[model samples]
Structure formats: structure tokens, C-alpha cells
Target: MGQLCLVAVMVGALTLALYVDAGRQAEQNAMERMRSLAASLAVNPFVIDAVQSPNPTALLQPYAVDVMDSAHADFVTIMQTDRTRFTHRYPSEIGGTFAGSIDDALAGRTVNQMQDGPLGPTIRGIAPIYSNDGRIVAVVSTGVTVENNNSQLLERLPLIIAIAATLLAGGAIVAVGLRRYLQRVTFGRGPEEIGQMYAFYDAVLHSIDDGMLLLSPGGELVLHNDRAAELLGLTLREGVSAEHSAATGQLPSELVSLLASGKTVENEVVLVGDRVLLVSQRAARTGGKAGSSLGTLVILRDRTDLRKLSSELDTVHTMADALRSQTHEHANRLHTMVTLVELGKGDEAVRFATDDLAQGQRLTDRVMESVDEPVLSALLVGKTAQADERGIELSIVTEGRIPSGLIDVHDAVTILGNLIDNALDAVAEQASPDDRWVEIELIASATELVLTVIDGGPGLRGVSPDDILRRGYTSKPGNGFGRGVGLALVTQAVRRSRGTLSVQDRATASEGARFTVVLPITSDANLNGNTAPVTPTPDRKAPQ
Candidate 1:
């Protein structure tokens, strides 16, 4: 990460330096050309216009022969203060407005290149034609064509390519070297298999499924495939105008600030009329010096349809769970009625059956009443069935609509699955048969999505909160790498969602554990895209 950051910073610094140098050179060139024109006019006072229409022979004879000098600009125009185009460069510009820095110069400010103009849109400076008493006579605006702007673009093109290409090429070369080194040093790759062991990542970069980008640490465009440019609203042209926009604009400030502060940041920047790009980046290095590598490959995944499909998938699972629970709940009620029929206590059994059925229906009504997210509601129903499967009573005690907007269907299902899995894992560990149960309470208020998963098992013991979310820390015996990645994955997933997850001994129950997860409720206002802070809320719980 540090290496990637450093490379990005260097690349940005170099680009800014190059731009400054180029801009300064262009400005200097404009001034020199202006000075030369003024000198020529002083020598022959008969010359006035900029295109040299009248000759030296006419200047010698005619009293005040107004001659336009030879000015090689994209477009040349002579206009009055009211912005009338006198004699334009192109026929198209004959009556166009001189509403640029030329007007400012007529009003006596040393204005340089204002807007698009004729030698095919030029960069120009205006100097007033002065008389003996310093009275302004006319404005002598000299400009070089914007078609000439291509020179600047060409000069810097190689540098842009070098910066972008270096990072990608470095990654490729380094991977190969690393693979070979590991084979030689640590038996990580076998002799026969090493040759066959190929680059899945090489294919990943070229895959058309998603557009890929490699960004410099400071968020400059680095290596991007053709698809990336299309996604990012960048030009398909390698022409002058395209190059101008590519290099001269101010970069997004938030991105630069993130990199400078040594943080790996990822977010979506809209392309105005293009795809909704989900840009995911990690701090990585090409592991080379300046001019040798560009740091950080930023991958852009087109998740528009993928996201919709994922949401649908989650909904399906939630509905399935809900259906399973409904089936089990009905079966249990019917079994009780059958037992009563065989016992011959008809009147009491009938009354008891009615009461029991009412209680069951009330539980269903209460669960279904407040929760509005159909997918989540279904998931809870399935979770109830899962509880029955494990011989434990599980219920969804939602106080309000399943926290709207903050979580999409997919994330909701994921959370539900993790909570249930953790509860099951806890229950499996309980040897003492006292209160072998699990409960999940989901409280959705206007402010938050509060989920509490409680299980009556050996309460989380001898695990430090600081280390609980680490990649490999598990409470299960043997410290084995094999069987303990589930809880860790859940922790990381929560962290990714910018939410908080905490585990504790159940507050209301003594013999079980409770994991409380609070995610800030997202409204429709913030839910249309990826505008989020990915910082994992520091586990504030003191170590147990």
C-alpha cells in the first residue's frame, strides 16, 4: 500500500510539473510574438491590419495605408468594442462575437486567451494600438491557432503513456518473477506444475465482463482498457481537443486528499450520461522507481445489472426461508390437534387447541405487521424454520419496518445468514442443556437498523474484541486454519458496509451471548449509488 501510494504521489507531482512548464512556455511564446508585432508596426506606421492584405509599395505611397500583417492563427478577426466581427478567419466566423479577452484588452487589461476564436479557436493576447498622446486607437490582438495546441498534447503524450503503461507492465513482470522465485526458494510451486501454473489475473485484466482501470496513487488516470474510457466518459479520440481535456482539468479533490492522507479509497464518480461505474481500488505497488511503475490498479465493475440480479437472489432466499417456516409452524399446530383427538379429552383439547392456534397466529401477525421488506420478512420466516431444524425456538421480533434504504436485499440476506450461522455455531457448542435457544431481535427506528442475535450457549469466552475481526483469529479449538473462517468473513463484510458489529454476553439473559449490529439507516436519498465511508467503526467494547 505504501509503495502504491508513493508511486501515485510521484506520478501526480510529475504531471503537475509538466503542465506548469508547458503553460509557462506557451505564455512566454505569446508575449514574444506580441513584442515582435509591435516592433514591426513601429518601423512602418502604415501597417494596421493583421493579415498583410496591403503591401510595402502601397505603404510608401498611400497616406495611411491600413495593411493587415501576416498573422498565422487559427482565425483572425477585427471587431469593434460592440463585438462585431470585422474580417474573420473562416466564413463561419464572419459575424461571431469578439466577446473574449480581446474585449478586456480594449478596456485596457492585459487579458490572455479568453474563449474559442477563429484561426480554428486560438489562444491570443490583446495589445492596444497607441498614438503619440497614449490614446488608444485600435486593439492589436495576436493569436496562435488552437490547432497548434496539439503540439503541447503531443509533447506530453509519451509521458502519459509511460506513467500508465509502467504500472501495468510492472505488475505483469513482477508477478512472473515472484512466481519463479517462490518456486526456487520455498517449494511453493512444483517443477512440473509451475510451468502449467498460469496467470488467472492476466485473463482478469483483459476480460470484457467489466471495465478495468489502473489509477495512480493520487487518482490520475493510469492504465485503462478501451472499455474503461467508454465507462468514464473519456474521449475515444486521441486528437488535440481530446488531449486538452484529458490533461488540463483539476482532479477530484476528495480523491487526492484520500491518497495524500495514506488511505486506500474507493467510490463511484458519475460519467454524466454514461454507466454507473462501481470503482473498487486497493493500495498496491508496481514495486519500481519513478518512471518505472505506476501504482494501484483501479478496477471498475459495471454492476448495474449485477446488483439488480444479486438483489433478486437475496429476495428468493428470503422468500424460501419464509415459506419453510410457515410450513413447519402449520405442521406443529396440526400435530397437537391429532394428539388431542387420540386422547379422548375432546372438550379440553378443543379449547386448548383454539388457544394455542390463536397464540401462533398472533406471533405470525405481530411479525408480519411491522416488517415491510418482503425479502427480509421471508428470510426471517426461513430463519424460524432453521431454528426448528435445530430444535430451538427462533423468531423475528421486528418493532418496525425492516430498516428501509440502508441495506439492499442482498446485504440484508447476507446479514441474516451470518447472524443465523453465528447463532447455530454457538448452539452447537452448548453441552449443558440449560436454555439451549437462540433469538434475533430486529428493531428498526427512524434512525437505525439495530439487529441483536442472542444464543443460549457458552457465552463467547476468552476472545479479545480487538482480535475478533482479524483474518484468522477463531475461538474454536486447535487454532486450525481449516475450519474457522465464517465469523471472520462476517466481520470483514460488516466492515466493508461501513457498519458496526459487536458481540457480548446477553444483557437480559445470563447464560447466552448476544451480537449487536447497528447499521445507520439509509434513506432513498442516499441509496442510489456508492457514496459511503468504508472505515470500520472501531470496536469500542473493552476486551473481555
Candidate 2:
């Protein structure tokens, strides 16, 4: 609408100007024609002879009428030096005084002016007729009336209309084109609406707690909030190109890949420094599903703290479930021993109880001696019970004492716990329960700690190790809601600790997989580990 109004104003102004200019040109042409006709008559030899004769009107009146008709002028008058008309368009008024100035004509001059005359208002030209002796004999005047001038101006009306129509059509086309362009660019928003939208968007972007990134189609950093900067550990400004950011090593390779792929992903775990972020990404389109790609939008949620809490909660639940199973098993054994003693089989009851005590005691003592960290020891104990409940043999072996503060407790749990759970799940799939087994090895050296979990079950079976490590890749069949992500979590935790993880077919077992992780733990002075690990109270009733 604004465009249309502007075009209308412009066309109207231009048309008015053209009309005014045409009127001026028409008036000029009329005046020039009249002046030329009057000058030509004043120089005619017949008019010069007639003007000096005794009866000049007899010869001049008819001649003046003929000239007037030929020149398309309203009137032509021949007058004396004293301004007495001798010849005129009206024969009866031939002797009447000419209603015009002839003083200049009498002074041997030619004049052109708009003046009131016998023919009402007119544009007239006057010229003096001089004898061969160069004395003024008479004057001739020719004019076109105001009405005739108007008729001449109307003659060019069609051309003026054509020009005006062309201008209007051109303006409308330009206006429509501009309107469509603006609509596409601005989403049909006016200046004020666009300004308001910008204000609202800025407020929302800054107010959001989650890290947000807006990229252009070319992957340039169009916008990023403060939270995004803090989470990504990047000092960024607007308009930073993607190449420059990647070259500067500010954006992590995972994030750069996501941006480049232009694929939509949700809740993807990305490890940046020591932070674990759950990133959600989608491509932004301008209009709708069919619209062109605008860019990719990424939202990052800091899941570091939540993951730690979840890890701890999972450990507690595992311990509780394991303790419950142990309680039930012990109760069943005690009942059997009581029945044996009641049946006078005290020797058998004592032997059976002693055997159970010895086996449980040795395993507990081994784990405590190998792992000084209480959380890991407790985790292993609980996992051992869970394995026994599922009829699978679980073994935990260690090369050296894993002292406290070797690695972050949460990272330790996320890595070791998930690996064990994954292994247990894998081995539980074996058809022969007696042949199923999972083993854990924690080797602590002066410079690093290596954790390995092996499972006896169907191996990778030609599946890529890298594919299994990606999120949402699970061998187990189900609804697949939370099917895959254990290994991904492990990967993220391993990366956070500046560690490495690898998966391969278990060489010891014909159909099993082995996973290994190496985490650096140099020294107290050089280590960039998290807070010191905390010791938990061990199960006092374990075979004691």
C-alpha cells in the first residue's frame, strides 16, 4: 500500500508538470506564428503601395481577410500611423480605432504581446509598414484569440495522455516489484514492525538460559548469546565467519560438523572442555516446510551438573538393588542351614555356610585392596551382585591400587559404570547362561589409568566400532526410546578427561566385545582432575 501511494504521488506530480510545460510551449508557438505573419504582411509590396494610396482600405481589406484565413488567426487589421483601422476582419468596423498599442509600430518597430483588442483578449504581433523612403505609412497587426490558443493546446492532449499512461504503468510495475521483494525479505513487515520484532528477539535471546547459536546458510556466526559463549568457552562477536572460528580453534570439531552437515539432531551429547552439553539443532526455513533454507539453529543445554547427579543416583539405585538381592540370597541360605540343623545335619549346614562366607569374603577383600576409591569399589560390588542375580559370572581385576583423585568421580562413574552395564547387557543375551561372563580391569600407572570391560556374547558381528559409539546406535531390539547412548556418554566423559576410548572384538572370547579407556592422571601438581573423591561406608555384613 505504501508503495502504491508513493507511485501515485509521483505520477500525479509528473503529469501535472508535463501539462504545464506543454501549455507554455503552445503559448510560445502561437506568439511566434502571429509575429511572423504580421512581419511578412508589413514587408509586402502591395501592402506598401496600398498604405500610401488615397483609398487604402479598398485594396487592403480583402487582402487582409485572405491572409487571416490562411494563417488560422482570429483577425488581421491594417491601421494608420495614428491608430485608425483601415482594414479589419469585420468590414463594417474597418474604420474603427484599433484597440491596441501602435506607438511602437509607428516608430518602425515590431512588437508581440498579449493584449485586449477588438477580438477580446489575444496574443498579437504588430509591425510597421514603411514607404520606399523609409517613412512609416501604416501598421499591420495579427493575433489569435485566447479560445484559439486553448484549441491549439488541446490538439496535443492525446500525446500527453499517452506519456502519462506510460509513466503510471512503469511506476506501478516498479512499485509491485519492490513490494514483493520487501515482503520476501521482511516477511511482510513494515519498518515499525521489524523494529519491534528485533527488540523482542534480542530480549528473548539474552534472557534464555540455554546457550543459543544462530548461523547463516553459509555457517557464519550470525548471532550467539552470552550463555552460548560461556558454555562453548568462546569470546565471540557478531559476524564472525565459521572458517575463522574453526581456524582459531574456538569451535569444537563436533559442533563444526553439525553446522556443516545442516542436519537436524536433538539432545546430542557434545563434550566441550570439561562441560557436557546436550545440543539440539534444526534447519531454519523462512516461510514453511517448502521455504528456502535460512540457516541452522543450535541450542545447547549444559548437562554437566545433571549428569553428575544422575550418575550418583544410578550408583545408589544399583547398590540398593544389589543389597536387596544379597539379603534375599542370605535369607535363603540361613533358612536352609536352620532346616539342616533341625534335621540333625549340623555338619553339613556348617560346611555350606563356611563355603559361602569364604567365597564372598575373598571377592570383597580383592576389590577393596585393588580400588582405594570407595565409589568404584561399591559400584563393582553392586555390579557383581547384579551379575549373580542374572546368572552371569562378573570378575573385577586390577593391576595397581587406584588412589582417590585419580580422575573425576562422576567421570569415573559415567565411564566405568556405563561400560559395565553395557557389558552385562551384552552377555545377558547369551543362550547358555553358564557360558556368559563379563570382566572388568582397572590398571593404574604413574601417569594414567586404564579401564577395560569385556563381555562374552555376540561380538560386533561386522559392525563398526565407531558406529556403536555414536548416540542412538543399539544392538538390543526394543522401542529404542533410550536404547543407545551408554557408549556415547562414555565417549564424552573420556574426551572431557582428555582420554581415549576404543572398542574391539574380545580376543579371549570367540564371540564377545572388549572396550578400553585410558584417562590421564599424571600427578597432584600436574593433574587437571576434578575435586578429590569421597569414600563411602562399605557393606559391613559382606561375609564378615
Candidate 3:
């Protein structure tokens, strides 16, 4: 519509300009013709001879009338060099002075000007009549009155109007066609509506908590939300290809591969820097199911905190299972003691109860002596009961005692708890339950905390130590939601604490895997002589 209106205005202006130019040109041509006629009359012998006659008006007046009719002039006048009229179209005005400038004509020049005369306003021309001796003898003037010029222009007014109307009609048609084309291109939306939709969509895209990515079919990034850039730790710019993104080493190579593959991926766990993201991707189609694919939509949900919470939940479940097992074991022990007393074997019952109490007390004392952190002590006790229920021997060996306030409970549980659970799983895989045994060692000093877990099971089978810590990399496979994040979580906790984790496979002795973690303990005044909780940095790089 705007285009249409603009075109209309332009066409109207052009038409007006054309009309004005044409009218000006016509008026100029009329003036030039009058000037030429006047000069021609001044050069005529009859007018020059009459101007010198004793009775000039009789000879020139009739001649002037004849010239006016032939040249289509409004009036013709013959005047002397002294401005006295020799002949005039009005006979009564003969012998009177002309009413317009004759100084140029008297000075022997031909000229034209617009002036008011006896008849009215006119475009008049004057030319000098010179004798053979080169002296001005008379002046001849010709004019076209303003009224007559306007009548001539009026005769062509209809044609000018017709052209203008035609042009206006053509412009209107073109404008209407252009307006329809614009409407089709814009999906029938007005400018205001389109602007509103753009603003709404932009707000919604950035407002989401999860990261969103839109990619072309060729794997070029089309759009990305703010959260996507924040989560991935990369400045996302539009039109960058997946290959280029991977080359920067900021985005994970695995994620790039998935994007380039153009295949649908669901709930796939991917490690981007130090953050774990649950990534889902689908091909974006233009229309329905059979429509062509336009691009791919990728969503990244931050699972770092969620995975930690899941790890904590797993610990809670393990503790509950251990408690249930302990309760059952205590019931059996009570039954045995009751039967012994009822069968008249009071000494045997006493010895049986004494040995049971002694073993339980020993395990509790070992855990208490090794770990001063209540969380770690409680975790180890729960593991002991779990190991006992599985008929596996669990031992806690301490070379140096861990002090209270030296570690965050969550971090300690995540690292050591996951390690013990993985060992337990390895030991449980053994065919001989009697041979299943796990050992844990805790060593702490003023500077560092060291933990080690070893199991009596088949070793890593030449698996790389780094490979075991990769998320979703597991030998024992089952379709479980939280199956393979244990070692990965352990690695994350260790790294956050600025610690080191090492895995040793004893392929010869014991044929088991040994895992060790060393965490540095900081004793700053701000921390009140306690170990500061390890917090992951925003730009921390994850292990490859």
C-alpha cells in the first residue's frame, strides 16, 4: 500500500511538471514568432517608404492591418523614432505616442518584452526601420495579447489532460499489482503484525532456560538462544558451520558430529566443557510428515546439577537397601539366640552373640577411626552392610586419619561413594561369591586427602584409564537411566577439588582394578582453618 501511494504521488508530480513545461514552451514560442514577424515588417520597403512620407498613416495603416491578419498577430503598429505612432490598429489612436518601451528600437535594435499596452497586457516586439544611409527612420511593433495566448493554450488543454489521465490510470494499475505481490510475499500480514511476531518470538527464544539451536540442512548455524551460548561456553554466531565450530575446540567434537549427521537424536548425553548436557535433536520440516526438511532443531538441557542430584538419590537408595539387609540379618541373629537359649545352650548363645557384636563393633570402629567426617563414616558403614548382604568381605584400612571440616560431605560422597559402588559391582560379577572382596583406604594430612579403592575381580581388560571416566562408557550394559555416570561423576568431583584420579589394573596380582584420588586441602583464614568446598569454575575444561 505504501508503494502504491508513493507511485501515485510521483506520477502526479511528473504530470504536473510536464503540463507546466509544455505551457511555458508554448508561451516562449509565441513570443519568438511575434519578434520575428515584427523584424520582418520593419525590413519591408513599403513600411520604410511610408514612414518617410508626408502622409505616412494613409499608406502604413492599411499595410499594418494586412500584416496583422497574415501573421496572426493581435495588433501591429508603425511608430517614428521619436515614439510618435505612424499607424495603429485603432484608427483613432493613429498619430499618438506608443504606450510601451521603444528606446531599443529608436536606438536601432530589435527587441521583445511583456508590457501593458492600450489594448491590455501583451508579449510585444519592436524592430527599427533603417534608411539606406543606416539611420533609424521608423519603428515597427507586433504583439500577441495575453488573452489571445491563453485561448491558444486552451485549445490543447484537452489533449494535455488526456495524457495525464492515462498516466495516472497506468500508475494506479501498477501500484495495485505491486501491492498484491507484496501481500503474498508477506503471507498476508501487515507490517505491524509482522513486527509484533518477530518481537514475540525473539523474547520467547531467549527466555527459555534450556539452550536451543537452529541449524540449516547443511549444518550451518541459523539461530541460537542466549542459554545455548552460556551453556556451551562459546560465542554463537549465525551462519557458522559445524566443522568451523568444532575447529575452535570450544564445542565438543561429538556434538558437532551429531549436528552434521542430520539424524534425529533423543536424550543423548554429551559432555560440553565441564557441563553435562542432555541433548535432543529433530529434523525440522516445513509442513506435515511428508513435507521437506527445512533444517534441524537441537535442544540442550543442562544436566550437571540434575546428574548430581541423581547421584545423591542413588546413594540414598543404596543406604536404604543396606539398612533393610541389616535389619533382616539382625532378625536372623535374634532368632538364633532365642533358639539357643530355648535348647539349653546359654553359653553357646552368649558366645554367638559376643562374636557377632565383636565383628560389628570392629567395622564401626574402623570406619570411625579412619574417617572423622560424619558423612564419610556413615557412607562406609552403609557399604559394609551392603557388602555383608552380598556375602563379600569389605575392609577399611587407614594409614592417616581424615579430620572433620576437611571436606564437603557432598563432594566426599560423590567421589568415594561412586568409587566404592563401582568396586562392589566389579566384585559382584565374580562367579565365586566367597572370593568377592573390596578394600578401601583413607589417608589424610594437613595438606591433602587421599582415598583408594581396590576390588577382587577381573581387571579393566586393557581399557584406558581415561576411557572409563567417559560418560556412558560402561562394560556392564543395561538400559538403566543412571547406569554409566558413576565414574564420570567421580572424575568431575575430583577435578572440581583440584585433585588427581589414577586407575591401576593389577593384571597379575589379585586380578582387580585399583582407583585412587588425591584432593588438596586448603587451610585459609577465610575458611576458618577448614577445607574450602570445591567449586567448579565456569570456564573449566572437561577431561577428554
Best by TM-score: 2
Task: Supply candidate 2's per-residue lDDT for 508.
Answer: 53
Q: What C-alpha lDDT, on a 0 to 100 scale, does residue 506 get in candidate 3?
A: 75
Runs in model 1 lying further than 4 Å from the true structure: 1-349, 395-406, 472-497, 505-512, 524-544
- Candidate 2 residues lying further than 4 Å off, grouped into runs, are 1-22, 35-63, 77-87, 91-98, 101-111, 126-141, 154-305, 336-355, 433-435, 505-511, 522-544
From the highest TM-score down, the ranking of the candidates is: 2, 3, 1
- The TM-score values for the models, in the order shown, are 0.38, 0.68, 0.65
Ranking by lDDT: 2, 3, 1
Residue 76 C-alpha lDDT in model 1: 35
lDDT, model 1: 0.55
Clashes (N, CA, C under 3 Å) per candidate: 17, 0, 0
Worst 10 residues of 2 by lDDT: 535-544
- lDDT at residue 302 of model 1 (Cα atoms): 57
Give the Cα lDDT of each candidate: 0.55, 0.82, 0.80
Clashing residue pairs in candidate 3 (N, C-alpha, C atoms within 3 angstroms): none
lDDT of 1 by residue, 161-256 (tens): 586568655755666677678755645756566545445545555567666655554445555566666555554333222223344442223223
RMSD of 2: 7.9
